[model samples]
Structure formats: C-alpha cells, structure tokens
Target: MLVYFRLLSESFRFAMNALRNNKLRTLLSLLGVTIGIFSIIAVLAAVDSLDKKITKDLSSLDKNTIYLMKMSFGPSEIPQWKREQFPNVKYDEYLYLKGAMTNTDQMGYQIFTKSESLKYGSNTVTSVNVVPVSHEFIDIQGLEFDEGRFYTESEANSAAPVVVIGNEIAKSLFEDSEPIGKKIRMYGQRFTVIGVLKKQGSGMFGNDDSSAFIPVNFVRQQFGDNNKGLVNVIIFKPEKGVDMDAYKAEISQKLRAFRGVKSGEIDNFFINVFSGFTDFIDGIISQMNVVGWIISGFSLLVGGFGIANIMFVSVKERTNLIGIQKSLGAKNRFILFQFLFEAIILSVIGGIIGLLLVWIIAMILTKALDFEFVLGMGNILLGTGLAAIIGLISGILPAISAAKLDPVEAIRTGM
Candidate 1:
C-alpha cells in the first residue's frame, strides 16, 4: 500500500514536471479533452436545468389534471380543418361537467384570448396575457398569491369588474404603491385589482409574471358566448388513486351525451392529460441527451487520441529513467502505474477546468436570465468518472509498452 502511494506521488511529480517543461505541448494535447468535457457537461447541465424548471413550474398542479378543449395538446390524427370547424367549449358545458362529473377532485373553466393592454392612470402596459377564468381556477391551479386574494365565486358569477394581476404587471403598473384595490383600465372599462400573484420567473411556455386574470363571465360578456376566436377550456383534477382510463371514459361519455353526439361519430373536443404533456417533454429531453452524447462522443474520441499520443511521447521521453528504475529492482507494475497515473492526472485536470468554466457560465446565465441553473452532484461525478475512464483507456497500451521494455535495451536506445 505504501509503495503504491509512493508510486502515485512520484507519478504526480512527473506529470507536473511534464506540464512545467512542455507547457504549450501539454495544453495543446489536453485541448481536446477540455473541449469534450465542456461540451458534454454544458449540454447535460442545460437539459437538467430545463427539466427541473418544467417540473417546478408544473409542480403545483396534479399530473392527472385534464384539459378539455377544441384543440389537442399532443399530436393528433385529426386534421386542422376539422379541428377548426369544431365548436368552442361553452360555459354551459363547463357547468354541466362541473356538476355532473364523478371521481373529480376539482374543476374550473378558463378562456384563452388575445393579448390586451392595461392602463393604470397614465401608466400603460401593453401586450399582457389576459387569462379570463372562473373563481374555481384558483383552487384547481393551486395559484399562490403575494397579496390580497382571488375573486369570490359570486364575484366571478356576476362578472364583476375585478382583476388579479401578476407580479410583473403589478410592478409595472403600480410601482411601489399597493396594487390591491387599485383600478386598471382594460376592454374600455375600469377593473379593480383584487389579487397579485407571486413572481414566477420565465418559463418554457411563457412567463406568468406579465399576465392578468379576470372573471370568465366578464370575457363572455365582452366577446359574447359564441365568439369563434375566444377559445375556452374546462380543466379537471381527478381524485388521487383513481383509474385515469375509466375517468377519461366517463368524461367522454358524459360530454358526448351532453353535446347530443350520436353513436359512431368522433368526439368534437379533445381531452389532454397533464401527464401526457409531461411524457412529451420527457421524450424531448431524451432526444437531446442522445444528440449531446453523439456530438460530444466525437470530441471525446479526439481527446482520447490526443491523450494516447501524449502518453506515447511521455514513454519515449522517460525511457532512460524507466530503465534505471527497473535496474534498481523496480517492478513492471511500478513502471506501468507511473505512466498510467500521469495520463489520468492530465485528463482529470483538463476535465476540472472544463467543469469550472461550466460553473462560471451557469452562474452568469442564472443571474442574467433570472432562471436557476443547477449543476448537481450527479452530473459532476459523471463528468469526473468519464474523464478517468478516458485517461485509463488512452494510457493502457503506452503503460504496457513502458512496463515491458528491457532495461539494458531501453538505456542503450535512450543514450
């Protein structure tokens, strides 16, 4: 054990000496490994961060939550023309489902409409996302409030001129003043702000921070109940441990009956499950992982070749020293380990530099974009382990050659 430790120590010193003596050559040789590590680690970090953010953004809602709408969230066999001709989900249907659906934990109705400008006195914010939803939306989506509260059921039913603003909208429109109870102008009318959502950072879909929520009834009043452009959806959260397939069947049958659809006709509306959407996201992440590995694998191959070249050169340069050590009763294993450790040290150092660069860039991106970029322990360990493996693979042949060299022949050749 002590001898092995001494061998490692001596190898480390030799590796340092190589770096010190041939700085430019060493750097050039390690460049491929550095870039390879950087490419792989950067891609992995980005994918991980994206996955985490998506999960965090959707964490508040149950995965079993379902959206019933004219459009499908995932790819569908239905053509666009047929989907377009399909009637929009109406308030009556939402009411019917809300009251009639069994095995349901909660349900809400919402409308997706065009972006609208909001005015608070002389201050104006343009192109803000307008989400007109029922009071039940708060419970269904599990929205958190920074101040005040969501509209009451009565308020939503009555189409009251009250609004809930997101954090960015509140900050932009009201500045330092308390936003609650402040009236904002939209749809050519004054609406009082009743709630402010917590600051949710940028997301994959869109930032919720610059959005405003109002009563769906208000939207119905303005756009009328049958407005073709006003897309409506009914969201449902199923009870925990319930059979999703059975629940979906129940929903389909009820809606088909409610819509007076006859047998053998396809259902007009689509039922999109949140879990299906997450599965789509997972597929995308997997594709990204495959692409990252393929691209980075080339770099690693080049890096391996570079390390092998350097190891061969190292063997040639230290032939005399190796011969002397063997003449002094040093074993074959000692000579092999000496070169092997030097190669591993070189690769690991390059990998460390690459990781450091990734960390710095992650910090910069997190601050600049206001999105958290996580570099987890697992990824770090994976990177280091890959580097070590690359080192070992690249060093093996050279180490063996060095170990097998005849002492007298090696000494004579070096002289």
Candidate 2:
C-alpha cells in the first residue's frame, strides 16, 4: 500500500510539472472540456429551473382541477368554425354544476375580462388584471389574505360592490395607509376594498401581486348574461382518491344532458383537466431535454478529442522519461494509472470552472429577473461524472502506448 501511494505521489508531481512547463498547451487542451461542461450544464439548469417554477406556480391547486368552458387547453379535433358556433358557458350552468356534480370538493364561477384600470382618490392603477369570481373561488383557488377577507357568499349573490386587491395594487394605491373599507372606482362604479391578497410573485397564470378579484355576479349585473366581452368558466376541484375517469365522465354527461345534446353528437364544451394540461407541458419539457442533449453532445465530442490529442502529445514529449522509469522496473499498470489520474484531474478542474460560472450567472439572473435560476446538486454531480469519464476514455490508448515503450530504443532515440 505504501509503495503504491509513493508511486501515485511521484505521478502527481510529474503531472503538475508538465502542466507548469506547458501552460499554453494545457489551457488549449482544457478549453474544449470547459465549453462542453458549460454547454451541457447550462441546458440542464435552465430546464430544471423552468420545471421548478411551474411546479411552484401550480402547488396550491389540486392537480385534478377542471375548467368547464368552450375553449380547449390542448389541440382538439373540433373545427374552428364549429367551436365558434358553440354557445358560451353561462352562470346558470355554473350553478347547475355546483349543485348537481358529485365527488366534487369545490366549484367556483369566474369570468375572464380584459385589463381594466382601478382608481383610488388621485392614485390610479392602469392595466390591472381584473378577475371577477364567485365567493367559492376563495376555497377553490386556495387564496390566502394579507388583510381583511374574501367577499361573503351573500355579497357575491347580491352582486355587491366589494373588491379584493393584490399586494402590488394595495401598495401602489394606499402605501402605508389602511386599505380596507376604502373605496375604489372601476367600470364607472364605486367598489369598497374589502380584502387584500397575500404577495405572490410572477406566475404562469398572472402575478397575484398586480391582479384583483371582484364578485363575478357584479359583472353579470352590470353587463347582463349576454355580455360579449366576458368569457365565463366553472372551476371544479374533485375530491382526492376518487377515480378520475369516472369523475370526468360524470361531468361531461351532466352537461350534455342539460344542453339536450343528442347521444351521437359531440359535446359542445371542453372539459380541460388541469392534470392533462400539465402532462402536455411535461411532454414539451422532455423534447427540450432531448434537443439540448443532442446539441451539447457535439461539444462534448470535440472536448473528448482535444483531451485525447493532448495525452498523445504528452506521451511523446516524455518518451525518454517513461523509458527510464520502465528500466527502473515500474509496472505497466502504474504507468497507465498515472496518466489516467492526470487526465481526470485536468478534466475535473475544467468542469469545476464551468460549474462556478453557472452558479455566478444563476445568482445574477435570479436577481435581475422575476424568475429564479437554479443550479441543483444533481446537475453538478452529473457534470463531474461526465468529465471524469471523458478523461478516462481519452487517456487510455496514450497511456497504453507509453507503458509499452521499448526502454533501450526510447533512450537511444532521446540521445
């Protein structure tokens, strides 16, 4: 064990000396490995970060949440003209589903509206996302309050002029002052600020920090049921551990019967399950991973070739030294292991530099953008493993050639 350790130490010293003496060559050799590590690791980090954000955004909602509407979340067989001809989902339909649907935990009615401005005395917030939803939305969306509370069911049913503002809107309009019981103007009507939403950063749906929710019935009362500007949807969150297929079937059948659609005819509305939408997103992410790996694999290939080239050159330069070591009875395996370890060390050094670059940029971008960029431990381990494997493969043949050198012939040639 001691003899082997001494041999390893001698090999380490030799490898360091080579690096010190051939600075330019060593740098040129490591450049490919560095770029390759950077390329592969960067791609992995980006995809992983995106996946994390999506998960975080959807964390509060049950994966089985259903959207009952006319528009499909994914590609559909229905033609554009046919889908256009379908009637809009109504408030009555929402009430019917809310009452009739079984195996359901919660259901809420909501209307999609265009961006509108809100006014509080002199301070005005422009282009605010105005979500008009029923009182049930509070439970369905799992909304938490920073101050005050979501509108009561009676307030929604009566179409009362009460509003819940997002954290950003609250800060902009009121600053340090109390916002509850204050009045704001929107749609040419005075609405009392009854609630304030907790600060949620930018998300896939929209930033809760800059959005507001009002009673869905309030919009219905103002525009009537036939308002062309509003798109109505009923959100359903099913009970956990229920058979999903049967649950969706039950929803479709109930709507079909209520609409008087013939058994042979296709249902006019879309049943967009939240889980299905996420599965579609997952498929896209998988494709991105494949494409990224293919592109980065080319960089790694070039990097491997560069390392191999350097190892061959090193063997040639130290031919006389290798010959003397063999004459002193150094084992072939020792020579092979020495070269292999040197190659691995150099490759690992390059990989570390690449990882460091990723970490620094990840921090900078996270600060600059609303989205967070993460370089997880799994990716770091993967990068290191790839570097070591490249080194072992690249160094093998060169190490073998050095180990097999004829000592007498090598010494004479050196002279």
Candidate 3:
C-alpha cells in the first residue's frame, strides 16, 4: 500500500512540476476544458434556476387552471383570419360558465391590456403591469398579502375605484408612508389603494413585484364589450380529480351552442389549459439543454485533444527521465500511472477553475438580476467526474506507448 502511495505521490509531483514549469502552456492547454466546463455548468445552473423560479411562482396555483379565450396559447390548426374573426370572450360567458360548468372549483374574469403607468402625488411608476381581474382571482391565484387586502366582491362588482399594488409599486409610489387608502391616478381617474402583494422575485412568465390589480369591471367600464382593443379571458379551475376531457367537452358544447355554431363546425374559441402551457415551456427547456450539451461538447472535445497533445509533448520531453527510471528497475505500470495522474490532475484543476467562475458569476447575477443562478452540488460532482473521465481517455494511449519503450533503446534515443 505504501509503495503504491509513493508511486501516486511521485506522479502528483511530476504533474505539479509540469504545471509550474510551463505556466503559459498549461493555461493554454487547460483553456478548452475550462471553457467547456464553464459552458456546461453555467447552462445547467441557469436552466435550474429558471425552472425553480417557475415552480415557485406557480406552486400555489393548480396546474389544471384553464384559460378560455379567442386566442390560442400554443399552435393551432385554425387559420389566422378565422382566429381573428372569432369574437372576444365576453364577461357574460364568464358568468355563464360559472353557473353552467360542472366540476369547477373557482372562476375568474381578466383582460389582457397594455402596460400602464401609475401616479401618486409627484412620484410616478412607468411600465407597470396592470392585471384587471375579478375578486375571485385572489382566491384562484392564491394571492398572499404584504400589508393590505384585496378588494371586496361588492367593490369589484360596483366597479369601485380601488387598486391592489405590488411590493415594488408600493415602494416606488409611497416609500415608507402607508400605501393603503392612498389615492393613485390611472386612466385619468383616482383609485384608492387597498392591498399590497408580498414581494416575489422575478419569474419565468413575469413577476408580481411590479404588478397592480384592479377590478375587471373597471376596464370593462372604460371600454365597453364591443371595443376592439379590449381582450377578455375567462379562467376556470376544475374540481380536483375530475374527468378533464368530459369537463372540457361540456364547456365546448355549451359555448358552441351559445355562439350558434352549426353542427360539425369547429368551435371558434379556444380552451387553453395551464398544464399545456407549462408542458410547452418544459419542451422548450429540454431543447435548450440539448443545444447547450452539443455546443459545450465541442469545447470538451477540443479540451480532450489539448490534454492529449500536452501529454504527448510531456512524454517526448521526459524520455531521458523515463529511461533512467526504467534502468533503475522502475516497473512499466509506474511509468503509465505517472503520466495518467498528470493528465487527470491537469483536467481536474481546469474543472475546478471553471466551477469557481460559475460560482462567482452565479453570485453576481443573483445580486445583479432578479433571477437567481444556482450551482448545486450534484452539478459540481458531475463536472468533476467529467473532467476526470476526459483525462483518463486522453492520457491512455500516450501512457501505453511510454510504458512499452525498451530502456536501452530509449536511453540511446534520448542521448
């Protein structure tokens, strides 16, 4: 055991000597592995962070939540003109579905509107995401409060001029002073602030930090049902464990009958389920992972070649040393292991540097951006293992060739 330990120690010293002697060459050789490791781990960390954020944002909400609207969230066989001709889902339909649909848990009415600006006294916040939703949205979205409360059902129904601000919005508009009961201006009208949502970091779709919620009735009041610019959507949450297909079919039948569509004709509107949207997002994420591996794989390949190149050069330079060692009765396995250890050590060192870079960048990004970049332990282990494997593969042939050299011939060739 001690003999093997000494051999390993000797190999390590040789590896360190090579790195110390050829600083620039070592750096250049390791650069490929460094970049490859960085690329791979960085991509994985980013995707993981994004996936985690998406999960956090959607955790409270049910995956089965459905969005009923004229526009399809994903691909559709229906033509553009036909989709355009489809009427905007009306507020009445939202009510109808609430009463008519079975296996429903909760329903909400919302509108897709452009970003709006809000003003409080001299302070103004621009590009604020305006969420015009009914009172039920609070329950549907499982919204939690920071300071105040969501508007009452009567307040929403009566189109009361009230708004629920987000944490960032409250900070921007009110600073330390109380925000609830303060009046803010939007659409040339003053609205009393009612609630402030808890601070949530950036998400895959969007964040709640800069969002504001007003009653859907407020937008409906602004632009009546016939307004072309207004986009209305109906959200339905089905009861848990219900037959989704039948539930959707019932919705389709009722909506079709209401729209007066003839038999055998396609339904004009779309019933987009939230699970499908998430599934689409998952597919995109998977494709990104594949692309990252392919691109980073080239770097790893180049890195492997670099390791091999450096080992070959090392063997040539150390020919006399190997001859002397062999003449002194050193075993063939010892020479092979010496070179192998050097290759692996070099690769591992490069991988460690790459991992450090990733950690540094992740910290900076977590602070710089709303998104968090996480470098988990599993990924670290994977990177280290990959580096070691690359080293083994690159070092084998050179190690074998060196082990086979006859001492007499090698010594003569070196002289």
Winner by TM-score: 3
Model 3 residue 400 distance off true place after TM-score fit, in angstroms: 0.8
lDDT of 1: 0.91
For candidate 1, the 10 contiguous residues with the lowest summed lDDT are 199-208
Give the TM-score of each candidate: 0.95, 0.94, 0.96
**lDDT tens digits, residue span 22-79, model 2:** 8888878888888889888888999999999999999998889999998898899999
Per-residue lDDT tens digits of candidate 3, residues 92-135? 88888888888888989999888899999999999999999999
What is candidate 2's local distance difference test score? Answer: 0.88
Tell me the tens digit of each residue's lDDT in model 1 across 107-133.
899999999999998899999999999
Q: Give stretches of model 3 more than 4 Å off.
A: none
CA shift at 67, candidate 2, in angstroms?
A: 1.0
Q: RMSD, model 2, all Cα superposed?
A: 2.0
Q: Superpose all Cα atoms of candidate 3 onto the true structure and report the RMSD in Å to 1 decimal.
A: 1.6
Instruction: For model 2, name the residue pairs that clash.
Output: none
